[model samples]
Target: MLSDLLMLAAAVVAGRDIVVKAVRARTVGIDLLVSVAAVGAVIIGNFWEAAAVTFLFAIGHALEAATLNKTRSALAELVAVAPDTAVVLRDGEQREVPAAQVRMGEIVLVKNGAKVPVDGQVVAGTGAVDEASITGESIPVEKAKSDAVFAGTVSRGGFLQVLATGIGADTTLARIIHRVEEAQDAKARTQTFIDRFSKWYTPGVMMLALVAGLLSGDVVLALTLLVIGCPGALVISIPVAIVAGIGRAARDGILIKGGEYLETSAKISAVAVDKTGTLTEGRPELTDVVVLDPALDRTELLRWAAAAEAGSEHPLARPILDTARAEGVAPVGVPGTVTPVPGKGIVSDVGGRRVLIGNPALLEQYGVTDDAGAAEAARGLAAEGKTPMIVAVGRTVAGVVAVADRVRADAARMVARLHSAGVEKVVMLTGDTRLVAESIGRAAGIDEVRASLLPEDKLDAVSELQREGHTVAMVGDGVNDAPALATADIGVAMGAAGSAVAVETADIALMGDNLLKLPESISLAKRTVNVMRQNISIALITVVLLLGGVFAGGVTMSAGMLVHEASVLVVIVNAMRLMRRTQGSTATPRSRWSPARPREAVDA
Candidate 1:
């Protein structure tokens, strides 16, 4: 009698809130059904069974809460990294204040081992900042004047005075947190169907239990059915997987938009990458100086080219001027009377002699004969992916000065890794000439090349890929690629730490500039989707077997509750596997070219 009273008290303690919540909400939940089943067991004098059912459920709830929080721990870690205090220069005095209180344009001081309190530009001093929180890069980046620094990064050494550009909730960390929460909560199409099924499955199970008990006159069997038919695993299977998958990606500095985007990312087959800033270094550099005039040496050729470009504002001018200065061949001052011809090059008067630096068209425009085979030399440079400029002094061609963008050391490795990751085609799209684009493509191991494309033409290329039944992912960094990015199946933005638009709008935003993350992201998405499928199968098979066991008569109430809780724990633990780092998650492939050979050789 004492055991029965104690067990009844235990059931009431475990079930009161559930009963009250159901009453207040005027709805029937699985918890209410379980509570009813426990109470019925207690009334039938099955004291141990009643106590075991409610106790197991209470234990399961506690475990679920703890483990679910662990699945979401990655985002919690991000929030914890947010700066709390800041040292700001107010009225030329350093003052400590809350990070959120620091006003924009105010100078913030960052000392050694201090966290950067705001996203801003470095105005003075130097430091090595560990930006792992923002970019997931383990190495510390060297920070100096005019360099952009983000909040939550640590200054490993030295000091800095930064002007606050973003503060409080406007910071990137806050935005990342917000995006992660929204992504975790978003539902996929399969999840939506399962949710709908669970809603009706609970009440339907209750009705089946009621009819079975009345017709068969077996009250204990009906109670056991209620304990096992909780839909615990089915309801939480997808959500836990989604939370763990997205959170793990965020920790690695890969931001997937949401569940829907994650689903689409798994289906990506083709990838289109921009040449400049994506596959190669965006900055052009002086590579070759061909002397057509036997009288002038390489240095003299560079000097004449730099003199002609000294007064021009073209994108290719800085490389010439910088190289000239490095080689001690820079002109004394800027050139005189510079005339820039669109689609050609610049013409200027240098040292009282007319200097022309451009393509063959510019030479023809000025009626300068291709004396000394300057045009053929320019074609040779162009074929090797170099932007060739003819240097002419008076009517005689001096030399052909060539400049080319340096291809990234990791470009070829990135292509190979993408293919290894199951990508069907890796295409290079660029506004550069056909020869230049093809040269880069060959070096990078790209499968196809779409050259000399305008911004709109890039979008057309992506659409054409889609029309061919290939799901395309476009990776780019500039505003011109934004249209193609939006039109592709998956729009990937790299080096996205400073770009607010890319951070918010890209399907997958890789915070660091590393190209390896591209293949890693796709691999992760594929693995995550596989986990989701496995979890769903586990849930459905568990439910089917439990229903079968209850009808065939050997599963008791205590045994049913234990199995139900075990299934839930299994699903949670399966999802947590995604949180751990795998070999493919962090692989940085080696360059295909030998270390002894210069990267410029490939560009040539």
Candidate 2:
């Protein structure tokens, strides 16, 4: 009687929630199946079996909950770092207030070891900020006036006065937390299919259990089938993998929009990148100034170029103006009217003379014949990967000035890593001349180049790749790339931490300027998809094995429950693998071009 009472107490304590859910919810689920199985076992006087099954299941439930929380540890850490208070300057005095209470445009003071309380630009002082909370980079970045600082990052040393531009929920950290939570809850395509499968699968299991008992008159067999037929592992298979994968990426500052994006990213075959910012520094510097007319010296040619460019806001204008300023021939008189020719260059009216600086097309548009071989000189500079701008003075060919943007150091490594991650083509799409684009492409190991393209042409280039049966990802940081980004299978925004638009709009947002995160995101998605598949397979196989064993011989209700719980734990453990970073995730891949093997080695 004592033993029976102990068994009854264990069933009540461990199985109460299951019974309540089954009765109160009016829905059939794993809870219902487990409740019915335990009740049946008790009615048949198998008290120990009832006690053992519920107890083991309760233990497994505790373990699963703990392990699942471990998978979300990265996101939890992010949430914990959110700033709670701010030190703001009010009426020339520092005041402490709730972080959210600080008004926009308020001056906030950040001291050493304090969390930056708002996203803003540094207006005074200097410091090294540990932006690891925001960018996932461990090294502290030096901050000064005009440099942007994000909330939730710590000031490693020194002090700073920040002008609050984004506060409270408007900050980057808040956006990241919200995105991660939504991504975790959003279902993948495979998860959706599994959900529909489980809708009928649970009831089918109960029906099979009932029929088996009725045909064979085996009460023990029916109870055992229900205990093992919960579908616990199968239902959680995809979600666990997605949560872990996304959380892992968030830790590394790579934000995937959702599970659907994660799936599509795994299949990316082509990556279309904008050449200006994505591949090169986007800061053009005047490299050469060749005088075509005998009357003009090198300084005279620069005077005309800088005179027109000084009134323009083009990226190429800065380098020319800077070079001229350093040479003591900066344009003293601003142009009366500066007209920008899209995809060509600039036409400016300076001191009552028409000063045209552009490509061959601009010269032709004005019917200016290049008798001085200005076009040929421009071509020679362009072939060397420089953007050559021909200067014309009142229809007279003046000279050719070339500007070049330095290529990023990690660009070639990024391309090699993309190949290692299974991307077949890395294409450069730009409005720069074909020769300049080709030069950049060869240096960066890009497979294709689409140059001299207008913004619309970029959209068409992405479409062309898609039409060729390629799953494309367009990477860029400008408005011109917007159409192509929207049309591609995935839109990746580089250095997205500074732009709210990029953070919200991109399919994959790399918070840091680091080029390596692109391929890391792809490889991670592939690993996550593989883990989901493996989990589903494990769940199905365990169910099949348990079913066969229950009928073939010695599988009791207790044994079936034990095996069912074990399989669920295994799936969770497999998903936990994503939370750990691998060495290859950041390592640069070796050059893809290898020497041909000997004939005997090829045969072998």
Candidate 3:
């Protein structure tokens, strides 16, 4: 920059009638304009104005570049964690190999502190892994054999042989990188304003310079006019603000992928929250137990259902197994045959009797929906967002287990804050039944509820809402929530234990588990956006004032440039003030959301 400015100074001293430098240096921003204007100044010997104009533009560019450079460090950090090779296990022997060369079913050994090189299943070892770089959790997670691991995660302990099912760009880390890059490139409202401003400003300045040249017999005046209207500083105002906003958010536990989400978040008319993980603790507890028959005790039913569920992998299964474990009720181990019915439930053998553990679909198969009591229990469970697991012996239902996701302590107040920030609607969406979704919705002060949606169907809901011309923000925390997150106008991911693929895929992510940050983030964005519009107005007004005085004296080319530079500084300073305001009133969190209210609500 210094070199460019000095070159402009040298070019100016050469005077208007004698130009000799190549086109390369002449195309280098304000320096080129300053160089031509400076030559005019020297030919006319207005040296002070020529040098000052060049100096102001150089400084503006420097500051603009500085503000936008924050993203480079994060990108660099990501690259540094990216592994270059893998330890491929072939024929029971581990061999050093390139990550890309490792095909499907290849086993790779990853040790502590080493990044997992591919998306694969852990075939051996029990160790804790830190996926926080991806999940934004501060705690390292325990991983065991048969557990899935993604690339770029740090194995905190133990040595593992991971069987590679996904490699290269197909890895979870790769997808995250791709999503982050895409979000970065996505245009923000503020960027559009700057683009539009520059597109017209440049041409308008050129025309103004021509008019000045026609009116003034001196060509130097026109050249000076061109120097006065350089759009360099004005072009960078909002981008610098956005870059800084993203950087500050990263520090506070939010990863804003692009300026668009940041800008849109400031204007969200309605916030559609995912109840299970967005506004709640998401970890459901085994809270209710009902026996279907007086002959079967509750403990026996829970034990058998847990035994059957031991082989099943589902979030709902954990509470049943965990409750059985806690009650000292040993699960029945006599499992000769077990078959998991897809999307319905699990059927297995217990002490020579077939036990079915699942929802209503499973009950209907056995002609066991015979009593009003059983149907009512299922209905009651659905009402509270609890999935009822029925444990049956022969064709008779023996026991029922009910579970509910715990809600965050701060969710209700957060909704109120969002409402205060201009959110017109607060809706809750969940795959849990209508009763559960509605129950959780009312607890969190949500105005509406959409429940029992499949993952793809959730995307359709977002599309339907967008078609209504509403700017929507979807907050979610599950891997199942990814498609909807991608489909929403703005996707906000809960960063903690939420899936890495989901977090990476989201436009914005809450880094810590504190969900109240959602409202805070929206508020901060609103203030910054408003400040940006104000700055542009101020900048354009300054341009108008400077142009009006261009020929009438007191507004030399250098003087106009100085005022423009000052205006740029003023805007940058104003935008930086947002970083100091609390995103809400506290720190940050990225954990899941779950409803924790009682089975029924109390009128306040």
Candidate 4:
């Protein structure tokens, strides 16, 4: 009698919430199945069976909650880094205030080793910031005037007076946190199907158990069926994997939009990149100035080029102006009038004479003969990987000036890593001439180069790759690349912290400018998808084996519960592995972005 009372007490205590939920919902669930089975066991005078079933189910629920929280640790860590207070300059005095209370455009002071309280631009002083919280890189990056600094990052050294651009929820850290939360909650395709299957599968199990109990007069068998019919592991299999995978990527500064995007990213077979900023420095420098006229020298040619480009806003104009000023031949003033010719170059009126600086096509358009072989000279420079421009004074060809943008040190390694990550093709699309594009392409180990493309042409290139049955990921950081980015299967934005559009719109936004993160993101996606598949298999196999054992006559109510709970725990444990950093995820600062040594120099 005492043992039966103890069993009754345990069943009521452990199964109270489960019974209450089933009553309130007026629907069947795993909770209802477990509750009814425990009640039936007690009615049948199986006191020990009743107590053990309820106790094990309760214990399993507790363990699942605890382990699932561990999988979301990445997001928890990010939330912990948000700054609570800030030091701001108010009326020429330093004051401490809540980070969110600081007004926009306020000048916030960050001391050495202090956490930056707002996203802003550094206006004074210098420092080394440990941006691991933002970029997931452990190295300290040096900061200076005009450099962007994010909130929740620590200043490793020096002090800074920053102009606040973003505060409170407007900051990048806040956006990342919000994005991660949404991604974790979003369901994957496989998960949706599993959910639909469970909706009917649970009721079907109860009906099958009832029919078997009535047909064979076996009450013990019916009780065991309800205990094992919970579908605990199978229902949660895909969701746990997705949460862990998305959370893991967040810690590494890669934000996947949602589970749908993760599945797509895993299938990325082709990568398309923009040439200007994706592969090169994007900053061009004047390298050579050849004077075609025997009467003029290098200085004279540079001076004319600078004079025409004086009033221009073109990217190539800055290098010419900077070089001319350094050589003490800066243009006295802006050109009187500057007219730009699309796809060609600029036509400017400098000193009451028409100065044309453009490609050979531009000279031909204006009916200017290429005297002194200026066009041929420009072609020679282009062959050497320089962007050459022909300079003309009225109808006579003046000279050729060449500018070159240096290829990023990690360009080749990034391409090679993409291939290793299973990308079959790495293509570069640019508006540069074929010669200039091929030069950088060879240096970067690019498999395909599509040159002299307009913005629409870039979109067409992505479409062409898609028609060839390739899943393409477009990597770029320019306004012109927006259409192509949207057209590709996955849009990757590098150095996205500063671009609000990229952060919000990209399929995967890599917070840092590290070239290696591109391949890392792809590899991570693949691993995550594999985990999802493995988890599904484990859940399904466990269910099938437990059902077979119960009918085959050795499995009891308590034993089946134990095995079901164990399978759920195993799935959660497998997902947690994604939280750990994989091999090659990081490298020493010296090996990152540093120029490669020449072949001859290395041999020596």
TM-score of 4: 0.95
In candidate 2, stretches whose alpha carbon ends up further than 4 angstroms from where it belongs are 587-604
lDDT, candidate 4, residue 142?
88
My TM-score estimates for the predictions, one after another, are: 0.91, 0.95, 0.74, 0.95
CA error at residue 141 for candidate 3, angstroms: 11
Local accuracy of candidate 2 as per-residue lDDT tens digits, 41-158: 9999888999998898889889988998999998899999998999998998989999989999999999999999999999999999988777777778888899899989999999
lDDT of 1 by residue, 1-604 (tens): 8877898898778767656765675556668777878888988989788888888888888898899999999999998889899999888788999998999999999999999989999999998888888877777888889988899989999999999998887777777888889989999777888878877888998998899999999999888888888888888888888889898899888999888888788888999999888897777888988898889899888888888888987777878899999989888888778987765667899988999887777888899998688777767877887777888899898988888887898889899999988899999988776777888899999999998788899999999999999989999874879899989989998888866877888989988877888888888888888888988888779878987988888788988889988988999999999999878665332121111111111112
- Model 1 Cα displacement at 69 (Å)? 0.7
- Order of candidates by TM-score, top first? 4, 2, 1, 3
Task: Encode model 4's per-residue lDDT on 133-231: one tens digit a residue.
Answer: 878788888888998989999999999999999988899898888888999988888888988898898899899889979988999899899888788
**Candidate 1, clashing residue pairs?**
none
Q: How far out, in Å, is residue 584 in model 2?
A: 2.3
Clash-forming residue pairs, model 4: none
Better of 1 and 2 by TM-score: 2
CA RMSD of all predictions: 4.1, 6.6, 6.5, 4.5
**Which ten-residue region of model 2 has the weakest summed lDDT?**
595-604
Error of 4 at 69 (Å): 1.2
Report every candidate's CA lDDT. Answer: 0.84, 0.86, 0.68, 0.86
